[model samples]
Structures are given as C-alpha cells and as structure tokens.
Target: MELSFQTVLSQVMLGLNNGVFYAILSLGLAVIFGLLNIVNFVHGALYMLGAYVALLGYTMLGPLLGKPDFHLNYWVALIVAPLVVGLLGIGVERTMLRRLRKFDHLYGLLLTFGLALIIQGVFTNYFNVSGDAYDGKPESLEGAVNLGFMLFPKYRLWVIGISLLVCFATWFVIERTKLGSYLRAGTENPELVKAFGVNVPLMITLTYGYGAALAAFAGVLAAPIYSVSPVMGSEMIITVFAVVVIGGMGSIMGSIITGLLLGMVEGFTKVVYAPASSTVIFLIMVVVLLVKPTGLFGKES
Candidate 1:
C-alpha cells in the first residue's frame, strides 16, 4: 500500500492524540512516585474508574434527577469524574497506603496491585467484560478542520492543545511555584519540612489526590475515543509504565516529552509495519534500559 504525505500527517495526528493520553497518565504516575515513593500500581485501575464514573454519571443523572432526556454531558463528566476519582484516591491513601508507608516499598506495590485487581473485578462483574460506549461529544467541539494536507477532528485538536496546556501547567506548578517547592522539599526531607511546620502528611495526601485527578482527567478525555471498560486501563497502563520508565519517574517534563515521542513512533510504525506498532515502545524501553539504566531524564541514585 502506498502512503501519501496526507496519510502520514493524519497518522501522526492520531498518534499525537494517543500521546496526549499517555503524557497525562504517565505524568500522574510520575507525580505520585516522586513524592510518595510508591509505584502506584493501582493508577491504571483508578484511570479505569474515572472513565466508568463518567459513564455512570451520564447514565444515572437523568433517571435519578427525574428528567428522562437530561443526561450528564461529557463536559460535566470531564470535571466531575476527576474530582470523584481524586477523592477516592485520597480515601485510599489515608486509610490504606499511609499505614504501609513505613514498611518496604514492595508492600505498597503489593497492596496497590491487589486493590487494582479488586477494582477491576468489581467493574467487570457488574458491567461484563465487553465494555460500554460513551457516544457524546460536546457540540462546540463536534466538527473537523481542513488543514489542507489533512482533515483533523476538532475534538482531537482540542485534546492535543488542552493536554499540552494542562501538562505544562502541572510542570510549572511542580518546578516553579512555591507550593511545588514545598512538595519537592517534602519529598527530599519530610522530617525537615515537618519541623518547619509544614503539614507534610496532608501535603502527601493532597499530592496523591492531585495525581489521581490527573489520571481521571485523562480518562474523561479518553472516554469518547476508547471503549469505556474495566480492562481499558489495565491494557494501557503497561504502555504508560514503559513511558514512565523511558521518561524517568522523577522528571515531569520527561514524561510529557517521551510520551509524545513514543506515541509518534508507534504511529509511524503502524504506517511502516502494522504489527510492530504495539511492541515498538517496549523495544525502545529495552534499549534504554540496556544503554542508560537511569532512563533518559532520570538521575542516578
């Protein structure tokens, strides 16, 4: 099959859209790992929860509110799902994760893995494994743009733009702002930060909440594009973990850049050789590990 410039451009755009989700999801993982020192295995499940929450919200709102035609829209789900998931993250942190903090890090990983399984299982039991559809797109974002070389979906372009904005805003907060300074300091020396009268525990809790919110936000953005299902995150999270590893867990900007690059690589691979698309990122990861174990942006321990 001969591919034209337009075909390549469109594929690249599609890849960028996938990259936006990867960036957002990996960014959340990096944030949670940076401060909490936990691998957050449940991140994928939390992400899945976010999508389900949006679906449930949209499906239930009308019936519960006694208005048959009045369903919760994507716009509302975009805001509400993250908040709901973030709060659930906070509850998990306060009740479960906090107790295991003093133990080996593996404990936390194990606990979160168990939690992930439980969450996925519950949703699978209720919804069945096939998955649910979220068909609505906001009216304002419902069209396509003729970019001369390619016709691009307006919603996808919006996703790319907004995702970049959110990712950068998050980077700025953690790297430039005063609150970010506090978070960084706490990560380095929690005892000292506490001695300085900072509520390090509360900050940690909030940080986890914030990270979960980021995942949930990604989920909302993804609902229209992907099937809303229990295993959605389970499948994507592995790729995301590779993104985090390649980008390094400690660098927020690294996650964003690596994700976008890998997404494009995967997209390009699809054009060149269709079957290699899924495994390309993992191959890159193996190369990175063999060459620089610290990752592209990670610091040596």
Candidate 2:
C-alpha cells in the first residue's frame, strides 16, 4: 500500500499527540522513582482522578452544592484538578508511603497497585465503564490552527506546548538549580542533608506530590483529546510503563526522548501494519531489557 506524504505526516502528528502524554506521564514516574525510590503503580489511577476531577468540578460540583450557576471553568479545572489530586498525593505520601520507607520496593509497589485497583473499582462502579465525553474545552481553544501540513486542534497544540514546557522545566529544576542540588544530595545522603537543617522528609513528601501532580496534569490535558473513562489510565499505564522501562527508570531526559521517539515509531508502524502499533513499544522494551537490563539511560545501582 502506497501512502502519501500527507498521510504519513498525519499519523506522525497523531503519534506525537499520544507521545506528549507518554512523555509527561513517564516524566512523573521518573521523578517519583528517581528521588523517592518507590514504584508508584497508582500513578495511572491518579491520572484518571485528574480527569474525573476536572469533569466533575466543572459539571457536578456546583449543582451538588446547590450553586448550579457557579461552576468551575475549564481554566480553573486545569489548575484545581491537579492541585486537588496533588494534595491527595501528599496525603498518601504522609499517611501511607512514609510508613513504608524502610520496607522493600515490592511492598511499595503492592501498596500502590492495591490503591490503583481500589480507585479504579470505585470509579467503575459509579461512572460509565466505557467512557464519558468531556465537553470541557475552553472557548478560546475551540478551533483548529493551521500547521501548514494540516489543521490541528488548538487544544492539542496547547497540550503539546504545556506538556513540553512542564517536562523541560522539571528537567531543569532537578538538573540545573541549587534546590535540585539539595534534592540530589538528600537522595544520596538524607541524614547528612537533614544535618544541614534541610527538612528531608518534607522534601520527599513534596517530591511525591509533585510527581502525582505531573500525572494529573497530563490527565487534564488528555481529558479533551479522549473520553474520560476509568479504564483510560489502566490502558495507558501499561504502555507508559513500557516507555519508562525502555527509557530507563529514574532517567529524566531518557524518558522524554524515548516517549516521543517511541510514539513516532508506533505511529509509523500503524501506517505499515495496523496490528503491530499496539505492541511495538513492548517489543522494544523486551529488546532493550535483553540488551541492557538497567534500561537505556538507567544507571547500574
């Protein structure tokens, strides 16, 4: 089958749309794992929570409170959902994760995995299992913008821009700044950093919250692109885990580049063989693990 350049570009753009989410989600995973040393299996459920929070904040919240005329707007939902979810993350870190600090990594993973299941179950019982359309797109981003090759939705462009900015800013914060130095120092030697009067436990709590916030941020972005569904995160998380693995756990730049690159690869595969796109990332993950168990950018501990 001969495909035109426009068709190829279109798939590439679609791939990129998917890629941006991968990049953002994986970035969060990397952040949590890098600093906290916890495998956050609940990241996906938190992402779903972000979307539900956005939808309900704008739709059900005002009415439920007998203030039907006062509802959260898209812009407000964008900020509120992440904040609320991040605060919830803070709670989890403080109340649950802190208790497991001295335990094996498997314990943390199991805890988070159970949390994800419980969250997903609760939502699935109450909400539509298939999906719910989110009509939360702001009026300002209602139309498509011409991208020379094609007209793309303004909301998608916004997602692309915002996700990139957040990812890069995070990378810079952790890699370039003085505070980052402290974080790294605390990661390396928390007791020593604590001796310097740095609140190491507080820092760890904040880091986990930040990572959860990142996942929620991605969820809000995705709310418009795809229907809000409980299973949405479960579906995406597996692929994202693959992305994280291929990029190397705890590797920031590696996750970003690998997410984008693999997205493009998945897109190209769709054009070549529709059936293979779904499994291409996993295939790459297998190969990468076979060659370097540590991952592409993951360091040997």
* C-alpha lDDT score of every prediction, in listed order: 0.90, 0.89
How much is the lDDT of residue 222 in candidate 1?
Answer: 84
Query: For all candidates, what are the clash counts?
Result: 0, 0
lDDT of 1 by residue, 204-239 (tens): 999999989988888888887788999998998999
Cα lDDT of model 2 by residue, 129-246, tens digit: 8899888788999899998888888888888888889989998998899998898888778899999999989999999999898888888888888999999989988999999988
What pairs collide in candidate 1?
Answer: none
Deviation in angstroms for 109 in model 1? 1.1
The candidate maximizing lDDT is 1
- Using alpha carbons, what is the TM-score of model 1? 0.97
Per-model TM against the reference:
0.97, 0.97
Error of 2 at 52 (Å): 0.3
Candidate 1: C-alpha lDDT? 0.90
